[model samples]
Target: MASQNDHFASIDIGSHTIRLLVARSNEKLEIYPLRLERRITRLARNFQEGQTLKTPGIRESLRVLEEYAGILKCHGVSDVACGATGVVRKAGNGEEFLAEVRQKTGIAAEILSETSEALLSAKGVLSVIPRTEGYILSFDLGGSSTEFLLLDTRREKPLWHTSVFIGAATITERFLSEDPPPLEAVSRAVEAIQDALAPVFQAIGSILPAPPTPFPLQVVGTAGTATTLAAMNLKMTDYCPSRINGLPLTENWLTATIEHLVRSTLALRREIPGLEAGREDIIPAGALIVREILRGLKQTHLIVSDAGLLEGLLLDLIEKKYGRPQALVSPLTWRMQKG
Candidate 1:
């Protein structure tokens, strides 16, 4: 078995960003992060229109991955897992892209299915929150899709999970034409989000008690969209992930933020304290999607989690190498849920 000193790394190549996580485990098998990096390459840019990743997007992703691989090598990472989500899964030429990526970067990028993305995201959130008395519902909003996981500690694993096609990049491309989108564009985007979330709402409503009955639920939000929102809420001149993680954002704040974002021009939004350079255009759609989710799900507040799929990937490596760590093994294992 690998000892406490073993270094490990995880790479998550998503539609809008590429991230890397490097960590080392302690005696108890709990890992501590050494470095976390995110580079916005917009891998899904023009993918819907072109049906293939654009050349500039592919080149940028390769550059980022090559740098990440070098970082892993320098750290002498003993175990590494890399995966691509949403964009790669949808692109018709995704396999060809992956081949070129592997040949250039020496990192095998597995394309994760929607279900796999959901589970990994859940694992990532649970790794941080551990357990909640009531049921926990978490969402990972990506550039191309939003993944959901409902975990009921009373049960063994997640009660249910799903992936909706509505996402920041896709919605922005489909609904909004002008920067600081006009009222009509905003309405269309909101309607699209509602339509996408209808089935999820239906499923949850059927499972929960009728209105006026208090639902035993807590909502958690993960991935880029949620964390970025938390950063913006704090209005930090320099975003600190430590402050963002486990932060609670109220529905009122989310609604207000959406209004602010939708009304602001892309240039103005880019000037926001925590807004990143490349996300100015798509953040309005992302903010709106988050607000609708809070309202539709009857969630008053959302706990923001910075630890997500990358963290989950590291935990999975630990579980596979050593017997499952207590932090990782739920009342129900992920494999059992599949069976």
Candidate 2:
């Protein structure tokens, strides 16, 4: 078991950004955050032409990881867990890049497979809400892929957990070739998103259909896109996780904002407060992902959760070192009411 005062760190190497979360365990075995940092490196830029991470992106990501290593060393944190998502998973040289990371920074990053990613992301959701009843649908929108989780608290595990290739960065790369894409381009993007999600909805099966679920459903959106949308809605000039988390983002607002964003130029988007500066080009695609998700589910609102895969990874390590604390959320055990 780790000492009570020991500090730990978790890193998520994502397609568009690389994030680090440093935390400390208290006397009572509860983990408290020490620092959180994110940097955009567009690790997936021109990724499709060749199924490999670009040299520039690789160098930039390694540079960020090296910086994180220095910080971790300063904090005296030796136990670190890092996970790489879609961009790395799809790239032919993904493992090679990780090898470079280990060699350069001594930080070994595990690539999360699709299903494993779905479950990890869902666990991330539990860290925030901790408990729930009825149906909870959550999606983590990323640069290369988006993962969805449908949890029925009455069951032990999720009703359905799936991943769709449609993502903000990928969609932008595919359809939005023009800056402030033309109407036709936007329409194509919509159609592309719809098509990609069709099969995922089909796989959902009974209980919750693709058309729309009833009153008891609660949709949650996690990760960058969701939090960014919440930040924009709040008119925040900076990224503040507290203000964003648990905040409700309604469908009306999402669709309206997406409309405004798609029509605005990249320069105009960068000027918008709360919308991260590097994200201007991809925000429209991210917003569209959120909008279409709600529209398909007939959900008017979704609660944004800033805590995600990174937190989940840390919590897992914490549990392994010290047995699962009762304070952490239990498995789904919601009882349903029948007419």
Candidate 3:
């Protein structure tokens, strides 16, 4: 079991950002976060064409890794786990980049497969909303890929999970050309999303029958895109995770946001009260993805969750470093622990 004040660290290196989370847990089995940091590196900017990580992206990622390494050492972290997703998994030179990162920063980064990404992401959300029940679908929309999990608390694992490459960065690279994005581009983006969602819907149907009548299905949204939209909907000048957690974003609000973003230029979008500065250009595509997902799932609202891959990684480490005390966790969670 983890002793009091033992620190552990986790890093999630994604296409659009590199995030580091440092947390400490005591014997009570409560984990407290010490530090959370994210840097926009745009690692997957043109990955589709190049098939390798761009030199600029690699350099930027290395710099952040080095900075995070120092912070981890300063905290005297007991164990650290770093994982790369999306761009790295697809990049031809991803292994080379990982090696260089390890050499320069002493952080060995593992590339998580799409399945692992979905699993860990589901685990992450489950850790946060332990009380949620009924049918639940959690989606993590990243820059380069989007992951979905059909969650059932009664089950030891996810009912169904999948990852698709039609993410904000990927869609933006493939479709958006103009600053605000032309109507044609926006329509094309939507069409492409519809096509990509076809297979996803088919897979989801295998586990969940399409109800003839509307039913209670909770749609939980996580990761940057979802959290940012929640922040914007709340008109928060500064992002707060506590406020964002369990936030209910209505479908009407999402539709309005997507329309506004599709019509506004990148410069104008940057001026939006709650939109993150570095995320202005990508918001249109990301927002569109969220809107379409809600529509396809026949959901009226999306519950925003700040806890995701990073939090999931931290929880996994804690479980491994300190075996789960059966008394502290529910039986379902205990079964998940076995996995």
Per-residue CA lDDT of model 3 for 1-339, tens digit only, reads 567778889999999999998877766667777788999999998779348999999999999999999999999898887889888988999999999999999998999988778777766776666465577888999998898888665566667888888788889888885787888999999999999888887787777755762435788889989989988988889777878888999889988888898889888888898888798888888988988888887778888888888877777777777786221122222111210
Report the poorest 10 consecutive residues by lDDT, candidate 2. 330-339
Q: What is the C-alpha lDDT profile of model 2 across 1-339, one tens digit per residue?
A: 777777878899999999998887744656667878899988998788348999999999999999999999988885888999988988999999999999999998999988777777777777766466778887989998999888887776777787777678998998885787998999989998888887766665465744444437788888888888888998998677767768899989988898899899999988887898788999899998888888777678999988878877777666666665532342312111210
Per-residue lDDT of 7-85 in model 1, one digit per residue for the tens?
A: 8788999999999988877556456678889999998876683388889989999999999989989998988888889
Local distance difference test scores for all models: 0.82, 0.81, 0.82
Flag clash pairs in model 2.
153-334
Error of 2 at 153 (Å): 1.5
**Any idea what lDDT model 3 has?**
0.82
Model 2 residue 184 lDDT score: 90
